[model samples]
Target: MSQQLILVLNCGSSSLKGAVLDNASGDVLLSCLGEKLGLPDAYITFKFNGEKNKVQLSSNPNHTGAVEALMEELKKHGFDSSIAAIGHRVVSGGETYSESILIDEAVIAGIEKCIPLAPLHNPANLLGIRAAQEIFKGLPNVAVFDTAFHQTMPEHAYMYAVPQELYKQHGLRRYGFHGTSYRYVADEAARFLGKDKNSLRMVIAHLGNGASISAIAEGVSKDTSMGLTPLEGLVMGTRSGDIDPAVFGFLADNAGLSVSEATDLLNKKSGLLGLSGLSSDCRAIEEGALEGHPGAKLALEVFVYRLAKYVGSMAVAAGGLDVLAFTGGIGENSDIIRSKVLDYVSFLGFTEDKEANTKARFGNAGVITTADSKAIAVVIPTNEELMIAQDTARLSGL
Candidate 1:
């Protein structure tokens, strides 16, 4: 096969995350696009294929603008401009896709049409693809949906008790997110454990700013936390995890708040920040709580409680976990979360080597579980971008 360059674009509701990777060597030729468009002082950073030199470009460019700027910068940075294809991290696939797909005008429209299903994210994801189509004209584009892997979810798991008409007309249903992250970590965890991906019954906690746990059976997503939107899952940086649907009605009737207002409050001002009244960062919360900050202490407790509950729930979903894996910012880096989560699952066969967990630096991935434990726990740093690049390369025949 000829050398192929695959670029992955990850667009958030308000910002851009992207990378250009070499397929054969598994090297990142470019690793930037963090520009928060319309927000000055925002910057883009890159660690170019192991070069000691790191590059930064400042100016908070939003998703669309940032994507174009990155394309321009690629040539200027002396990158090989012949990209074989582009891969996009689309958040919702609705019922349209069961796997990674080569992008077409019709496919793009289908993805865009699902915006209502993932109002907060799919649109921004669409923006990135729209920009890529215009900037990288003639190049093949692939969309690897965050909900794609979960499409394997059984109907009973994804179906709501709501009227069938609502789903048929508005696509109202559970479409789990963070699939790319789970997929990468699951495969890597199996490789690290010297087991085949399809052979393990593992519980994967993709804890980060947005957190979710997946029950992986035979290498496919059997169950996941995030549903419809990221807010439906485990407690996260700013989004409320699972909540009673009646709360919306109660608040609307008595609190004088509209549904939209309530939604914003939950998605942007809740979670760790709401609970702590401090920063949303777990590190800050852990440090503050340890020092006797009341709100922080409560916040940390709640966070851990929610995580423990879900981890245990997923263990049941997987029919009991043989291995438990943690990935994402908090999952891979927060020793405190690891300790707390493991402690909660001790009854369900989780083991932890405190010294090993605290010292592990996670990019290359390793086992954080102890030798004597029945259930092996690991910290596998996620690389959704690499997975996207690989998928795009495969689909594009590069």
Candidate 2:
């Protein structure tokens, strides 16, 4: 196969993650992350050919600076000239983009219009796009939306039970996040089952620092847990999953908090951190719980309960669940959490194989259900970067 390279950029609020992949094989040739982008001690880490290296910047680096540094590093490794196209992960496509498209001036503008919806993400995404454009002049660029895969959701599922005008005028409805991860894992799960994707009813739970669950029926997104933003989904590292809308007003009245403050609190200071009052990491909470810490125990219980509840809800949305697969950081690594949650969903006729469940970790994919279980449970690691690269290659005609 020809060694066509596809560069993927995933610019988050605080980090810029880039990977150079062999477009034909979807194999990552080089991967790097620019961390603490806006901080004084910003730095970058690169991994290539099984070797990891780090470089500390002398001063704070913005998105453009990060991209520039990454390009320079790739050039040193002689991978720059192999690049055929660049793929950017834009968080919101709103009502416009349902699939990856070649990034042009109009597409950039469309992404810009979504700034109000993904205020924290789109701008940062734009910064990366502009930076890559300058560095890789004339390279075909593509915008792969995080919300694109979920665009298949029916109106009843994405619509909020509010005034119609709110949705019509402000787009105030559920535009699920993590569509990229969900898309990759859904297809992978189908392949693992040796069945056609379009014939399966699957509920995928992507549990990570930021988490969301997706319900896919007939190879289309039927419903998802996330809403107008990622904060509306399952409990995350620091995010509160589901909450009463009235709590915002209540917090303002009694806690002297503004809407923005309340929003930040839920997105950054709640979840496992608030519940455990020890740490936001599941591993840390697991350790604390083992030590008989009540808060940590409660947090773990809450997280598992919420995950089980959403799995049940998604099964309902898909009419019935044939495959229940877990992916993402916690889902891939934490066997205990998966086992506990599966216990709650036993009514679905899923029986967990304790040994297999404990062994699936670090990108190792396997089935964790009893041979005769009615419902199949498996662990499939997600590869959003490969999905982005594939979309970029396809749309760019590489």
Candidate 3:
């Protein structure tokens, strides 16, 4: 097959990550990260041909500036001419999109319409899309939404207990995130297990700084931890996941905080950081726990307990878990976390291969359960960028 190059862009509020990949071979030719965008000390880091380099960007760089810098890097590496299209990682498509689609005026409007649902992410994603359109004029742009895969969820799985009119009017229901990661891992899990994708029932735990779990039955997302936004599910590095709604009113009355402040606190100040009163990084929390720090131990326990609880729920939602797969940063690297989670869910017939779990880190992917276990457990590193590139190539007819 001939090479089909697709430039994948994942833009955050103040950062842009770009990768040029051969869609046919799934090999990344070049990758770059523009950090601290719109700040005075903005800079960009690039990795290509096994070499790493960093360069300072203009003062107060914006998304367009970052895209231009990426373009320059692409040109420098002679990859600019071979680019076929650009794929954007959009965080929310609401109920409007069920799959990846080419970006157009109508799509942009649809994205804008979902701004209230993903207030922080959709705008940043739109910025990246517009910047890429400007920098790479006429290149087909395809949007791969993080909520699209969960669109297959049944009505009962997505609807809230609130009045039906609210959901009908505002679309206030569960729309899971990390779908791109889930999509990648579900296929990988099937391949690793040597089973047909549609025949497997898998529960995927995407544990990272921003964590979530997904239940895939017959190769389709049935239920996921994250809801309307990414803040609804598993305890993240800083997010206080699955908190009671009353906490907002209680904090307002007792702590004299507004709804906005309470939301910010939950999304930014809680989770491992709040529980441990230390760092948000899990590695640090694990270290502190090892050192017998009470707060860190509590944080670790709560995190693991919540994670295991979700795993159990996802297992049920998937009907039966034939393969319990772990992905994302923490899922792939943290044997301690994985082992703890498995121990909690041992009732589900998952027996951890301690040796195997420890070995499946740092880009390694393999089964981490005993051969005789009823259900298989595997650690598969997620590659969302490659998924995006493939979708872009197929959708754009590259």
Candidate 4:
């Protein structure tokens, strides 16, 4: 038997989140988060066996340093040496994948081909891969893509009404992100609802720094919020969700700004933080709103409004919704946000349990819907790392 440990490397533009798991038991042996690497500020932390700890990396760290740091901690802080595999989270599949697959040079090249579509994400993901290859040189590492689940979305839903030539020439269509998380939660929802995995329809809301809603029908992704890019999705931490294209030309004509500059403003300066001046984080806005901050109130309201509208539309797109789930930092932790989302859909058989909701269950999956409610409301903490580990195991035959 192969005593393999699969490590998940999730490298974002400015940070890294990784976890090493024991494939036999699905236990997370080690998880590390390196923040601000390659940026002005940087710090590294390691969560050993899912415990909060100060697993430190050296000063002036970058992506490579972050990977090295985690390996050192594993050696020092007690992890089995049977780690035989690594799993990487690659964001954009760009029609190259419909499922998680084994990683090789060709897979790496395929990911690189998707860089233009995901300029900000794919390169960082590749960095994590390279870092693992350097540190764990002999191990088999697999890649689990975030766009793989949405491959089931029909072209009518995934395609944009733009010139077919651009899409035909550039492979430019809606390649959604968060497929791993959505798939993870959707499966859990089916289990929680006691529905057969292949026949259930669920709407999963993954709300966090980057948020998206997916409508999964008969265990396949039918529609999702994010489009061609993350910027097109629901209003994100800093990215403006959806905007009128005509505004770009108008801003250029009236404000004398370039397309790139306008694009930057929408992606970096506009969203909850821009609308709420108090903070980009949902918790901060909720607190600020309680303290009578106008910007905070506006931000909170807009965020919830965006969520409710999308949930309704997703239900319509799915033909109907059997279950509605919440996951991610804000979705699982924030009761206020959950309440707001539920309130908008009361007419659709969603009713909340105040007592159960008040007791926030971080990382636990359960129904928060009222006993009599037809459409269930659930809080399912996402486990992207576990999904990565599972994929890695399947590919490595461990």
The backbone clash count of each candidate, in order, is 5, 0, 0, 0
Q: Summing lDDT over every window of 10 consecutive residues in candidate 2, give the lowest-scoring window.
A: 56-65
lDDT of each: 0.83, 0.92, 0.93, 0.86
RMSD of each: 2.7, 1.3, 1.2, 2.2
Cα lDDT of candidate 1 equals 0.83
Worst 10 residues of 3 by lDDT: 1-10
lDDT of 1 by residue, 1-398 (tens): 23577888888765677787888876777777465455655555555656533233354345555665676677776554667799999988898988999999899899978888888788888888888888888889999999999998888778889999988898888889889999998889999889988878999999888888999988888888888778887988888899998989998999988999999989999999999999888889999999999989988888889888988888777777898898998888888888988898899777789888888655646677789888899889898989998999999988
lDDT of 4 by residue, 304-384 (tens): 999899999999878898888899998899899889889999999999997778775676667888899988889988989
Compared with the true structure, model 1 gives a TM-score of 0.92
- Evaluated at residue 102, the lDDT of candidate 4 is 83
Candidate achieving the largest lDDT: 3
Mind giving the per-residue lDDT tens digits that candidate 3 earns over 311-344?
9999889998899999999999999999999999
Model 4, residue 188: distance off in Å is 0.6
Cα-based TM-score, every candidate: 0.92, 0.97, 0.98, 0.94
Model 3 clash number: 0
Q: What is the lDDT of residue 328 in candidate 2?
A: 94
Ranking by TM-score, best first?
A: 3, 2, 4, 1
Residue pairs that clash (backbone atoms under 3 angstroms), model 4: none
